[model samples]
Target: MIIAIVGATGTGKSDLSVSLARRWGERGLRCEVVNADAMQLYRGMTIGTAKLSIAQRQGVPHHLVDVLDVVDEASVARFQADARAAIDGIIERGAVPMLVGGSGLYLAAVLTDFRFPGTDPELRAHWEAELQRLGPADLHAVLADRDPAAAAAIGPHNGRRIVRALEVGDLTGEPFSAGLAARETPWRPYRQFSLELDRPRLVARLDERVRGMWRDGLLDEVRALLPLGLERGVTASRAIGYAQAIAQLRGELDESEAIAQTQALTRRYARRQVSWFRRDPSIEAMDAAADDLAAQVDRRVAAELVDTMGG
Candidate 1:
């Protein structure tokens, strides 16, 4: 059986995945992790992305981690094919594939048979050039006027996707949302779980998490990645803490200001993640901060996997 662990950031989703994997391993069940987190795909992104080291992983095999350089674009289409292939191989080997991360769209792309509209190179380049000249907010305004719903769905911060939306708009002369509202059955069936925490408590934890990343040498990690062309990478450059930390390094923000901005921005992003995952009725919610959270998740996943295997 395949399992997906999802939820908002700072909700202990990663820890719970390790807990369940350890528990299942002790029970003689073989399982491995396939990451759905977009940022963790880059190498040398450990401290900021909270990527586990080999020692921390405790022999649990992980796929799709560190598979991309900072220079590579993270394409959901590519991930969908790669992850599904991994899941299929794991199932064939009689081992379960545990997909984990808070990247809702990437998770959906892997779990569901979502398709993207066609792209034109020249049209895309035109929009991207406009993005460079006018910036994401201005380009986003153009999309808002052309297709407000699409603009709303694709946030202004996501310049790559904003470019795609405009390209689709130019090509189709239709609202990009029309393509999104269409859906189909998932690539494979699995039990999906999401973690939840109280807003106040989550905020506190998020603040600590941001501080922890910095304490763990996020500045050093970013400094190392800079030589690897991190700033030139469109997607990698804007990652939550990475962007602010880069600003700090560039003398745009002091260390304290960068940390504060990262914390606040992360909280807002987490809210968006919750909104994205909650819209899917298939995901079962679980208490992330509960003392018995690990056991509770184990029990549910245990029962579901048994029934699935038997059937």
Candidate 2:
């Protein structure tokens, strides 16, 4: 069985995953992490995504991190394949696969047999050209008319996602959300947990985390990746911190302005993440601030695994 560690940003999901793996390892139960964050797939995007360093991983193996260049567009379908393969291998070795991330769609893509509609080169090219000509907001408006729910889930500034949503709607002759109906079957049985933090505390954590990202050389990291064509990369360039940092580099935003924008955007994105995950009734939302959180979560996972794995 697979386990998903999901929630909003700044909720300590990564640390908890490592802790759980370490605890389970003592019982001779091997566990490895599978990356579900879209941006974390890109190499050299360390500081911005708050990825765990080699030593910080605490000897737990992680898959799919840093597997792509900044110029590569991440395909959720591709990630589903890669992550499931990693999980299958871990299971074959009698190890647990921990699927961890805050990206709602990415997490779902891995946990479920979510089928994305096929893309059309001619149709996709037309949408891309229209997106370029009309700009994100206008294109978003067009999407709203055709598939309002999809448009609502995607941000206006996310032109690539908007284009894909429209492309899917056109091909299926149905709203993009149609493919995402309640699933009777997933890849396998899994116990999913979502860590939650109250908004006030979450805001403070986000503020501190944003400052930490800056102090830890987020700007410098972005600068280093620019030579790798991050600026020209459509998908990578729009990453939360990278986009703001790029604006700072181009003199569109000062250092302070960039940091402020990053914090605000991160908080907003966290809300969206939580909202998305909340819609999945299968996920047990854990209160991260609770004193018994770690114990509670570990016990549930241990019991369920024993039962499901026939221990």
Candidate 3:
């Protein structure tokens, strides 16, 4: 059986995955961990993304983490394809595949079997040229006219998403939201689980984590990447911590101001993630902050897997 562990950042999803993998291993069940976080795909982005260490993995096999160059544009379609292949391989080997991370859109695309409007190289080129000339807000306005629903769903400040929506509409003659809504869910192949926490406690944890990130030299991480000449819209540059740090480095703000701004943005993102997962009835949510999380998971997973094993 396949299982998914999902939650907002700082919710201890990875810790739970590691604990479960070790428990299942003791039971002589084969399992592998697959990453679903978008930023974790980039190499040299370890600390900023909170990527798993070799020791932290505890010899459990992991797939699809740190597999991309910082400059590479890793699309959701690419992520879906890679994850599908990994899932198939794990099942073929009689192992359980556990997908774990906080990237809501990426997780939704894979679990729902959402198909993008086919890409047109020529059309994509045209849109890229137009984006360069017109800038993001103008392009976003155009998309708002063509696909108001998509425009509403995507933040206007998120230029990459705005550009993508316009490009998809140009290629498919349909809105991006329409394509997403039309797709059927494919998660029947897996049993999904979600990690949740008390709202006040979660917010407090998020604040503390952001402060810890700053103390751990998040600015230095961004400074190291600055020499790479990374562009503004690349996925890594837009990461919650990286974006604010870059602004500070560029003299747009002081370090204290940057930290405050980054923390605020992260808090907002976490709220959205919580809302998204809450809407999905399929997720079996568990209190991640509880002292007995492993016991709770064990009870639930045992019941579900009993049926899978036909016992």
Candidate 4:
């Protein structure tokens, strides 16, 4: 059975995954992790992304992390294929595959029968030009008028997603939400667990985490990636903290302003993640702050695995 550990950022998803894998290993059940977070997929984006180092992983094999250069645009369709292939290989070798991250869309694409609509080059180019000319806010306003639900979901700051939503509407003559609305049967048998905390607590944690990123030298990390084409990266360049760091590096925003902006954006992103995952009825929610959370999850997962085997 595939195990999914999903939730908002700073909810200890990574720590939980490592703990679960280590526990399962002790019990003779091998578990390997496959990352679903988009920013974590890019190489050299460690500090801002909260990506675990080799020592922190404790010998657990991880897949799909640091697999792409900063300059490469991350596509959900491509990730879906790559992640599924990794899971298939893990299952073939008699190990449990764990999908772990805050990215709701990437997790859904891998766990469900989500299909991508074809894109037209001309239409994509048109939206890109519009994004450049009108900027994210204006382009987002156009999307809000075309599809209010999509606009609400994508948000005004995310020009990439806004453009895609508009392109999808014009290309398919359907709201972008239509694609996300279909909750078809999953492609594989799986159990999902979501870690959650109260909004006040989560917001505090998120703000502190963003501050910690900068304290841990996020600026230096961005500097390292700049030579690797970070600014040229359509997707990577716009990641919450990375963008702010880049702005600070370019002297556009002062250090305090950049840090504050990143904190605000991170909190906003966490809210959107909560909203997205709450829509999935298949996930079982757990309190992230519970003292025995890992033990509780391990017990539940053990019971589910036995049931799946018997059935």
Candidates' TM-scores?
A: 0.92, 0.96, 0.88, 0.95
lDDT of each: 0.85, 0.87, 0.79, 0.91
lDDT of 2 at 232: 83
| lDDT, model 3, position 146 | 87
Could you give candidate 2's per-residue lDDT for residues 1-311 as a string of tens digits?
89999999899889888988888889877899998888889999999898999999999999999999988888878988899899999888888899999988888877886887788988899999999899999999999988877776676777888889989988889898665563435879988999999999999999899889889998899999999999888779999989999999899999899999999999889988888888788899999887756567788878788776668
Between candidates 1 and 4, which one is better according to TM-score? 4
Poorest 10 consecutive residues by lDDT, candidate 4: 302-311
> Model 3, residue 254: what's the lDDT?
92
User: Rank by TM-score, descending?
Assistant: 2, 4, 1, 3
Displacement of the residue 168 alpha carbon in candidate 4, Å? 1.9
Q: Which stretches of candidate 3 lie over 4 Å from their true place?
A: 121-149, 182-184, 228-233, 306-311
Clashes of each: 0, 0, 0, 0
Name the 10 consecutive residues with the lowest summed lDDT in model 3.
179-188
Model 4 score (lDDT):
0.91
Candidate 3 vs candidate 4: the lDDT winner is 4
